[model samples]
Target: MSAGAAAIRVVVVDDHPTFRIGMSALLAATPGLEVVGQAASRAEAVGVVLGADPDVVIMDLDLGDGSGVDATRELLARRPEVAVLVVTMLDDEHAVYDAIRAGARGYVLKEAQPQEVERSIRSVAGGGLVLGAGVARRAMEGLAARADARPFPQLTDREREVLALLAQGLDNAAIARSLFVTTKTVRNYVYAIFTKLEVKDRAALVVLAREAGFGGDER
Candidate 1:
C-alpha cells in the first residue's frame, strides 16, 4: 500500500463475539486497515458487509447460523468488487476449495500468527490470492487429483469418510472414535477403501485422499 493511501475498509464475520472483538481490535491497531463492521451469522454477514461496502471481508467458515462459504458466495454475488479473505479454523483442501469457489481471494487458518493474518488481508485487498502456510501444497495436490479423474467413483460414502480422516493423519482408533464405530469396523472400512481406491496401505490412502481433496466435515 502506498504511504498516505486510504485505509482499507474491512468487515469481520464470525459467530463468536470474542473473536469478532479481538479481530476488530487487531485490525484497528494495524496502520492501513479499518474494521468497518462485524457480523455473527450468515444473514448478518450479508447485511453488514453490503451495508459497510468494505474493501475486504474476513470470513469464518462456520457462522453458527450458516456456512461461511455460503456467506462468501452471497457477499460476492451482491458486490463482486469486494475481496473476501476467509479466516477459518478449517485447514483442509476441501475447505480451501470451497472458499475459492465461493469467490474468496484469500484463506488464512485461525491458528496462523497475527502477522500472517494481517498480511493475508493486505494481499487480498491488493488483488492477490493468499493461502495459509502449507495449504497451497494440499490445494495443488487436490487439483492434480481432480485433473486425473476420480480413480474410484464407486467407493461408498462411509469408506470416503474413513479415507478423509486417514488423510488428516487420524489413526484407526481415533477414526473409530470419531465415527462412533468399533476399531474392527473402522479397519474393515479402511480395507474396503484401500481395495476400492487400489491402494495398499494407510500411507497410500492418505496420498490419494490429499490428491482428491478429501478433507471435509464428516459430520
Candidate 2:
C-alpha cells in the first residue's frame, strides 16, 4: 500500500457498460482512487486484474463467462497480495459469504452509494474487512437459520448423547458425572456436538436439540 504519491490502482469488472463507465468515473473523481482497467466477463476480469496488478479490484458477482466467486479465488491464488472488493447486484447472504469465502475482502451491492463504494475500496486496500449495509446481519441470520434447518444429521451416537445431555440443561461438569467421564472428555464431546449441529453456542444447541426432541428420556 506504500506508493509514493501514487493513487491506489483499481480495476472494475462488470458486464454492463453503463455501470463500468459510471464506476470508472466515480473512481476517477475520488482522491487516491484510480481506475486502471475495466472488464466485462470473469475471464477478462482475471486477465485485466492480473495484468494491471491493481491494489484493489471491483468485481461483479455474475459475468457472462463465469462467476466472480471463481475469479476472486483464482486472483487470490495467483497473487495473494491483491485485494478483491465484490460489487454485484446480488445482496443475498449466501452470495456475500461466498465472496468472502473466495477471499474477497469487501462485499458491496451494485446499488451502494458512490461514497460507500469508495470507502469499501479504501477499506479493502488498507487490509480491512468490509460488508455492505445489512449484508453482515443477513449473513449472521443465515447462519442461525442453518443451525435450526435440520436435525443433527452429522452427529454420531455419542455426540447425539452429548447433545441430549446439553438439551437437558446439564452443564459440562454435570454431564461428565452423568456419563461417567472426565470433565475434559465431556467438554470435547460438547464441542464435537456443537460442530456437528452447526450451532454457535450451547443456547443455540439447546434450542435446536429441543426442537429435534433430544431432551426426551429415550437416551
Candidate 3:
C-alpha cells in the first residue's frame, strides 16, 4: 500500500450488526483500505457489491436469511474480479472447505485480530490466497488425514463417511441412523457425492466406492 496508491475498496457483509459496524469502522480508519458498503444478508451482499464495486468483500458464513457460502458463489459468478474474504465464527473443516469451494479468496475466524483481518483483506485484494494460522493448520490436518489413500479426496470427511456407508449397502435412513444425522442430511450428502464423483446411479457409485478401497470395514 503505497502513499499514492489507491486504497482498497471493501464491503462488509455480516449478519451481526455490531460486528459489521466495528469492522467497517476499523477498515474506515485503516490507511490503505476504504469501507465502501455494508450488507447483512446474502441478497444484500450481492446488491451492495454490485452497486459498490468494491475490490474486496468481507463475508460471514451464516446470514440470517441465507448462507454466506451461497452469496459468495453468486457474487463471484457475477463479479469474478471481486475478491471475497470469509470472516466467520465457524472454524469447522466443513464450513471452511465449503467457503473455499464457493470461491472465497481468504478465510479467517472472527476471533482474528483487527490487524490480521486487515492484512488478509489486503492479501486477497492483491490476488493472494490467505488463511488464518489456525485455519491453515486445521485444513492441513484434514488433508493429511485423507492423504492419498482416501478415495474422492474432493469430498469432505463427512461426505466420505456417507459414501462409505452407502457402499456398504446402507440406505439413506440407515446412514442417517449411523451418523446421527437426519435422513434429509444424509440424502443431501449422497447427492453431493454423486455429483462430485459423476456417478449416475447408486449401484455404479457403490461399485466405484468399492473399487477405490472404501466400504471394506464392517462399520
**Model 3 misplacement above 4 A:** 148-219
Please identify model 2 stretches exceeding 4 Å from their true place: 1-4, 150-163, 166-219
Ranking by lDDT: 3, 1, 2
Between candidates 2 and 3, which one is better according to TM-score?
Answer: 2
Overall lDDT per candidate, in order of appearance: 0.88, 0.87, 0.92
- After superposition on all C-alphas, the RMSD of every candidate to the true structure, in Å, is 14.4, 8.8, 13.8
| lDDT tens digits, residue span 1-219, model 1 | 688899999999999999889999999999999999999999999999878999999999998999999999998999999999999878889999889998999998888899999999889998999998767777888888785575456777788788879888999999999999999999899888877778787777888788878766543
Candidate 2 whole-model C-alpha lDDT, 0 to 1: 0.87
The window of 10 residues in a row where model 1 has the poorest summed lDDT is 147-156
Model 1: what TM-score? Answer: 0.65
Q: With candidate 1 superimposed using the best TM-score fit, by how many Å does residue 114's alpha carbon deviate from the native?
A: 1.0
Compute the lDDT of residue 78 as modeled in candidate 3: 99
Q: How far off is residue 4 in model 2, in Å?
A: 5.6
Give candidate 3's root-mean-square deviation (CA, Å). 13.8
